[model samples]
Target: MLPEKTDTVVVGGGQAGLAMSEHLGNCGIPHVVLERARVAERWRSERWDSLVANGPAWHDRFPSMAFADTAPDAFATKHSVASYFEDFARQIDAPVHCGTEVRKVRRVEGGTGFRVETSKGTIEAQNIVAATGPFQKPVIPPVLPELAGLTQMHSSAYRNPDQLAPGAVLVVGAGSSGTQIASELQRAGRRVYLSVGPHDRPPRSYRGRDFCWWLGVLGKWESKTPPVGKAHVTIAVSGANGGETVDFRRLAAAGITLVGRTQGYDNGVLRFNADLVANIAAGDANYLSLLQEADDYALREGLDLPAESAAHVIPSDPGCLTDPILSLDLAEAGITTVIWATGFAQDFSWLQVDTFGPDGKPQHDCGVATAPGVYFIGLPWLSMRGSAFIWGVWVDARHVAQHIAARHSQATG
Candidate 1:
């Protein structure tokens, strides 16, 4: 049931694609949204059962609709988030062809427009917006050897502790997902070991405000990319326990064993980098630096905010840092499961467009690609640091839609 032609074709059905469709409709541009599965398929299927929005409901939503009957500061469950996107798509009347996968997108012959092949049918469009979100492919580092009988899966594939083997669990990457999974397993009476990595330790709430609110009010959301040679670190904050800070010390105190970054797998043993203490210190530094910034901002603005406690600024050393474990035998430790909460990577192999950079990411000025009529949306930091999240996707969608509208106008006029 695919259309033979359209003014544009959006290549996703998530927040970014739906937002793009809404804007395209606003500008009287005819387009259809192509989704491989139901709307918000990843949110509906890929996330863990207990997963909740990392940001509160009010901040992590599109401008068109608010999460119904949900508190502004409350984190919506994964199911609720998927329903929200489904409801948004319905309200916007987006022409989304769910269960229709886009197999390939390439420039049509004669150097004009593009031809898109899909699971349903073929469609030709004047412009195509690659609104595929950031978490397209799970990235599990090859730090561990292929051990027989070990239950290994990415965070996306993880559901609950009961699904894991009845043994100790090793969760790699101490980002929000890793920490949350480790905590869940430990609470379920399974010994858990969490692999620490370079991550930002932002408090869930700082100075009587959510960290997200601080990012917005302090103009941090409008921050640009980091300078050359600076890698963006993952923020280690959680929305679980009704939105609380992810303190490694507290996690260790709760009986989750902390380990350094996974180095590699050797003869019947796992190796770790001897950087556990350094990692903890770096995370503490990040936390304290954010606190200082918030305090300075409040002071300059003459705003009466709650003062953070000394204990909150200074972190206590955990026992694992003092006595780091550089190697472990999985069999000896009774560890039978390994959940990789590392992260995701972008896959653009089907996008046969010369718009990608040396890093294999789409090269665009804002959302407009270097190749004519080829646009990209929803990738992390596509235009700004905030572009990685929900609200930011909407903003980027609008910008890309405007560009497409202008181009369409020029072509028709």
Candidate 2:
């Protein structure tokens, strides 16, 4: 039962959409939240079974609601996170229409409003909030040539080691997801080859404080988006195994084969970039930088904190750095599965508006798009470094909702 008209329509039912709905309700703006599946569908279905929140439970939740059952320092599992969002939606009384897929959104002819077509029915709205979040579509690079017998899948589709083909696994991309998956596969007795990439390596905790806590205290979450030409790299830290630093050297020492970035597949063999050593060194530098920042902050504030020893600070070079694998034959090494943990791409094809840039990304100032009445939320660095997280989504949602309210008042007044 879709409404014939509404003041606004939120095009997602994940954390972002639910947050937007909460703020809209607070402002007394009538809106409907449309979700393709159940609320927080990605967390419910897309994530790997072993996945946990990278941030601790306390910091990862909405400000108004706490993970009452979860320990403050403990990381909530993916199932818990999904349930948390669903519970929050219920608590806020968000009008989320699950199983309602938004097929297309286009400007209504000769009108200031827009028309949203969904699987259930059509809805006319004055504003549209694209809360589709960051991870919309999985991105698998075309570097590897397709083999007839090879099993391939993205990290999003991966569940557990048992789900993969019983053979050696090649996990491409050294981000948190890739590393975690590769480590899990190796520990599960599969020979794992992890493709190294440029990434920031932050310790899960420092001086009895979680990395997220450090970020909050240091005001790093308030950091703005990178300047033009600079890229934002996600930190490779994990809350698995009761929280631990994501050190490649340690992973390699534990028996995972380390390799350079995947280049392309040559005649029946896969080639990789000869930059494994450089990538390792860069990750080490980022790790050290964080340690240094934390140490300096403690000293400046005269806070008593445990100091890391010099020997502990420097990690021994792994064998992979000295003897990097540049190429490999899948058949020769008995590799059967290739997991692409590369990343995801934005899919706004249904959004028929001129709000996208040359890179196919939404062109917006914060959440407000270039196109009138079109807005975006749940994007990384949308407002700050925290924009993609739970608390940040609420902040940005409130801002967007306020803007919409102002616009509505101006139009109706």
Candidate 3:
């Protein structure tokens, strides 16, 4: 039997939701977490079989649970990450209601609460926390129209090179997914062409320490710098294999052909921008800027950070800097598969409130939605750049939980 109302209701059962529920429980506030599928469904099914957390297991730990028996620097596979969340929820005794899909969330007309309609039942609560992670919907551009014979799949659906058609594969977007997938395919003996895009290619490590460690040391992860209210920068660094940097130079050295950003398809020919070199240069410059910031911070703190080896920096190779292939005839290139590693967009269609900005993203000051009592957790830059990652979500989660608890107390008193 479901309750008619509750003090607070968390809208998802993932790490963010569970984290918020933990805090709510600590405050002696009642709450329930609703999930459309089993906990961490995206980790279980959406990612590739061999995919692991972009950061190390140690950094991926949440406030609810420390990663026990796991190597701190080792990458946690998708299954392991999902299992960790499941275990965390269980150990914390989070009130999670799995298989309960939220169909709609509307303000209780003229009231100080919300009505969350679900597939199972309606949940009335004084507060609602939308803990849906940042990547809500995979963005396959409108220009990615289906070709008659060639196969197409988004990176979210890609498993491995074995699942692809046995021929050349064209990976669009040079972010982490694009670079990583292209590397995997090329190594699997498939000719892979990677399309370079506007991306930041920070090295996986710098100064003999993991780049993330430096960021944490410099207080970048927990920096209270407010978001500029613009689209957040796309960060695409990787920490695979105990922190090996994956960039254009590394991919080219591994036998992957690089191309410019994909423009569109016209008359069965794919078009690309003639800016591959410029894009790569820009990415390298951004990496250098971040490295300089880290160096400055270390200097101010009197830390003796090791200097980076120029030879190990993986600079752009002449062979990889060929003239851009402006237009590619797919058949002539022998490309049989195209994987769009583009990105994702938030989907708040189920949210019946009107506090969203022009970008369709909810406007929140640190996790509290503009519509009072409606909060969001695990959103990109919710508190800082790190807020989107598992290692950083607890910052926003705790704040939201306490905000709700305070509101509940005021109502009761």
Q: Tell how far residue 316 is off in model 2, in angstroms.
A: 1.7
Off by over 4 Å in 3: 223-232, 311-316
How far is 2's C-alpha from truth in model 1 (Å)?
A: 1.5
Model 3, residue pairs in steric clash: none
Better of 1 and 3 by TM-score: 1
lDDT-sorted candidate list, best first: 2, 1, 3
For each candidate, the alpha-carbon lDDT, in order, equals 0.88, 0.89, 0.81
lDDT of 3 by residue, 1-413 (tens): 45779988888888788788888898889888998898888888888877878887778888557776568888888888899988898888988888999999998987778898999989899888898887789988777566547898899999987898788999988877777788888888989899987677666778777777877886768866743532444566665555567677778877888888888887778888888888888777778877888778878888887877562464546574765678888888899999999889888899888789988778999999898888999887788878888867877787887888788878889
Q: lDDT score, residue 329, model 3?
A: 87
Candidates in order, TM-scores: namely 0.97, 0.97, 0.94
Q: Against the true structure, whose lDDT is highest? A: 2
Decoy 2 TM-score against native = 0.97
How does residue 354 of candidate 1 score in lDDT? 93
